[model samples]
Target: MNRREFLKKTAVSAAATSLLAWPNEVWAGGTVNLTILHTNDMHSRIDPFPNDGRTNGGLGGMARRATLINQIRQQEKNVLLLDSGDIFQGTPYFNFFGGELEYKLMTQMRYDATTFGNHDFDNGLAGLQRQLPNAGFSFLSANYDFSNTILKNQFQPYQVFEKEGIKIGVFGLGIELAGLVDKKNYGATVYLDPGQRAADMVKQLREKENCNLVICLSHLGYKYENAKIDDRKLAQQVPGIDLILGGHTHTFMEAPEKINRTNGHETLINQVGWAGINLGRMDFTFSKKSKQKINVAAAVLPIGKTVISS
Candidate 1:
């Protein structure tokens, strides 16, 4: 799982015939291909940008994103759609609907899971509580202790999904909400250390749950010049996370960054830009005989523009 080995495993070129026949021959054989589609920091841009002269003019919209996701699902058999949080605020849609439409639309998109970002507390805890039922997916928050608040039992720390006999474990990690959020808004939620919580969650998911792949839905920013617990720092600190889908910094990573883990394994960290402009896709091929994932491919599909895969 070193950098070289990681590259070799996922080094299959996009032009390879094996990749072309992935959708058909994957499940029939002992290999299983799991496609993970993700988004982050949507910020309630339900409609596309106005026809003005801005740079992002008409570049993003829910309809286009939905169409792209649907097309991908049609080709890929086992797919998991996920979000990395900040689904609220920014646009006037949230100011008017209080995140109801956002949740409903995501539910329609069949998002498997999402984490909590600081802006998720914009309408305060009560507003989030009201919109919780509208979402079709679960909210995973491992570092946020909502036990003493009204959000008790409302969110899970981790979830396991079985796709084509491969057990995939996913957990959530949020940024520290103290300085970023108002006390009146967040209420009695306790924030735990993401690094420690992640270590514990990874141990449970890898050992007790026996998951073939472990993913972390992180609302932490990508990285900081200063000392901050960003996604890169988290990957270096935690051992078991195979992938980290991050938000909060609105980083438009052209591709996933492979970080060499302390245990000699590698962790993939990816984040699409904000405003529903991009969809992140990662494909991992698992070998049944070895009980280990062998291949990894990623594609960053533009929402309303041409598609690009790497």
Candidate 2:
């Protein structure tokens, strides 16, 4: 289907149910289910937007997000919370705390992993390093080479998580920072070719590691008219990537775009808007015997008063 049609179909599907329902047939035959909850470009929104009658007024807040995540964790057995990037900057909270509070709160909410956005370098490498201790999760970025800076050996190219006999391999990709971010802020950090890095990660994660699912947390936006290698391009160039949770464009996609890869496999790319206004969720049911994905469901849930009070 075309992008517009795909989006329309999925948006309608999501509107019908807050959480997509998994068909019973897909759950039969010893299938394992996993729920992935994700956010991107949160930009240090500690509290909900002021009730100023604007479009996004009273929409997002870290507290509301935490409560929603906790509720999902209680319902799902295998849950992974991930962020695509830009965990820092935007609001006064980031300006005052320099991302320390953001890291701490994400730690409390038990974020599994995150990638780096260009704005994440606003405080420079040293500042980011100082706040690293507050985060309980790993920073995964396969494309950015930090060996020459203080961030050397600080981030992982990818991470593997196993739950209920299912192995999940997750890696990260970042946007090129030269033009987007100041050179002084990202000094000595070399940006690698994201397509090549992703190919390498897929080989290791799928062939070497034998992961049942492969996910890429990408900060490469969704798509670009120019040749900037956005998430859509990455999906087309790389094979074996099952899902891509993306950011950097703050594009509010109601549903994920399913791209058919060259190798006959498919990839799902989803990115919620910025400022923690929405949470992107994807549910997958896999066959335990064949180690293949059987079914999938998704939703872009808005963070509003329906959730517990912040």
Candidate 3:
């Protein structure tokens, strides 16, 4: 969908009321609302795009995004700021600073967690490890085994977050790096099968951890015409993931698409465009009576001067 249509369908003023059709009784019976804000492939576009007559001109700036996030935080009680990956490469900021600025800025934003994109390996494992101290949040990667590399024990396979007595399980998955990345850059970072890893993660998160909501921070592309294991395929193959926030292909989805799983469950997949043009938001309400059951609403907030004024 185009930007105009997307904004029309998911207007910022109407997002909270229109996304989900749950009744008032759900909120009256001790329902907890969790707001998830996500971004992906923000390849060092710290400043707003130049107003050079391009389609993306005058859109996307970290400061503007921060303003929007702060606005939301003031209004919402439980909020999670996350990224899907590819936090490096694209602009001269990465070339000069080597991801230090990116990490520092995301730290300032209080990002809860993030996954790895193939470009994250551009500077090799050591470069990534060197800048880890600047980040205060966690890095989650379920499929990439970092045992043999310098990143061993640096990332968790999955993390469980408890907010207002609700357990939210979050995990990360990266695309295969061997073919997409330089061998020297991603040396010894063994890539595992994402489908098997996702199944294992879901089982552990649901059965053992007893998580109320399961989310996957996936760097897998949204969908591929070929037989690649993209987010759509992963959602179809795995039954328990409630949501997949995706990246890598830089797809600008008009809205989250629902994929039916084999076990009669539905997984929602969402991806904003690259370069921090949009911030993806998903609100989930869980009742005390049924913590495992949830009602979700999604919106894509465009970051710009107009948005700040609105």
Candidate 4:
């Protein structure tokens, strides 16, 4: 069976149902730290897995995820929650509701933004578009040209946000979904060359928009052995993209990979494992003392088989 099929057969568990200490200094302190929380290849597994003898038996569920997100947002002065994609198709939740539950839960969790994955088109363009309005966060896909379709103006090429004196630019890049998805499902959504589009968008975000941190929310997976384009290639070829949050490969990276781009700019790539069993967190610390990016502490936190609330 294909990877998606394997996950579909084994990953489904439950529906959406229902963390931590803040340093006192955070509410009234200097050295503002930005916490970036992310997920990918969620695949609509809305509940923590039951005791199934698997390594991650009891982890992941939208309700547990929301509890964690709310806890962090309440403490951090600046927090950005994002997802890379594959937000549809896995459990009967998606099969029955047609992605409504996933989008609604994501909306409740306040996802800042997300891209597209091939599986997102399982219900076809009309089905996906029908549920679009329910999403609180904007959908961005720089390389997917939706012109001549209903999604043209509804989606953005990139989004810029200024948080705590920091400028962040986020955009999306989709994998080539032709061979991966049914032609009838994706319809006339023209897929552009990701490398070319990445270069162009990075230039615009860094030079024109003056965004200090440029991030690419990618559903392009990570490195592949062959010539197939992936996130690693995009990072090496595109300059000025500070980070690439990736999906589509279900790559559970130990930590974010630091790579030097064509212009010698540093880019960090990270992806949590599939099924929401892990939550990827990257802490960006900008030193006002030196006026530079001082450090990045990255971790993949496990939700691990049980629901915990703070």
Query: Each candidate: how many clashes?
Result: 0, 0, 0, 3
How many Å off is the CA of 128 in candidate 4? 0.7
- Model 3, position 96: C-alpha lDDT score: 95
Q: Give the winner by TM-score.
A: 3
lDDT of each: 0.86, 0.87, 0.87, 0.81
Candidates 1 and 4, the one with greater lDDT: 1
| Candidate 3 lDDT tens digits, 11-71 | 5532432344556676567877788999999998999999899988999989889888887
Deviation in angstroms for 89 in model 4?
Answer: 0.4
Off by over 4 Å in 2: 1-28, 305-310
For candidate 1, give the lDDT of residue 184: 95
Check candidate 3 and list the clashing pairs.
Answer: none
Tell me the tens digit of each residue's lDDT in model 1 across 6-73.
Answer: 22433322211122233434444587778899999999999988869988887889988898787667
lDDT per residue (tens digit) for residues 125-213 in model 2: 99999899999998999999999999999999999999888999999999999989999999999999999999999999999999989
For candidate 2, give the lDDT: 0.87
Clashing pairs in 2: none
- Per-residue CA lDDT of candidate 4, range 64-102, in tens? 888767766765678899899999988999989999989
User: What C-alpha RMSD separates each model from the true structure?
Assistant: 5.9, 5.2, 3.8, 8.7
Give per-residue lDDT, candidate 3, residue 47. 92
Worst 10 residues of 2 by lDDT: 11-20
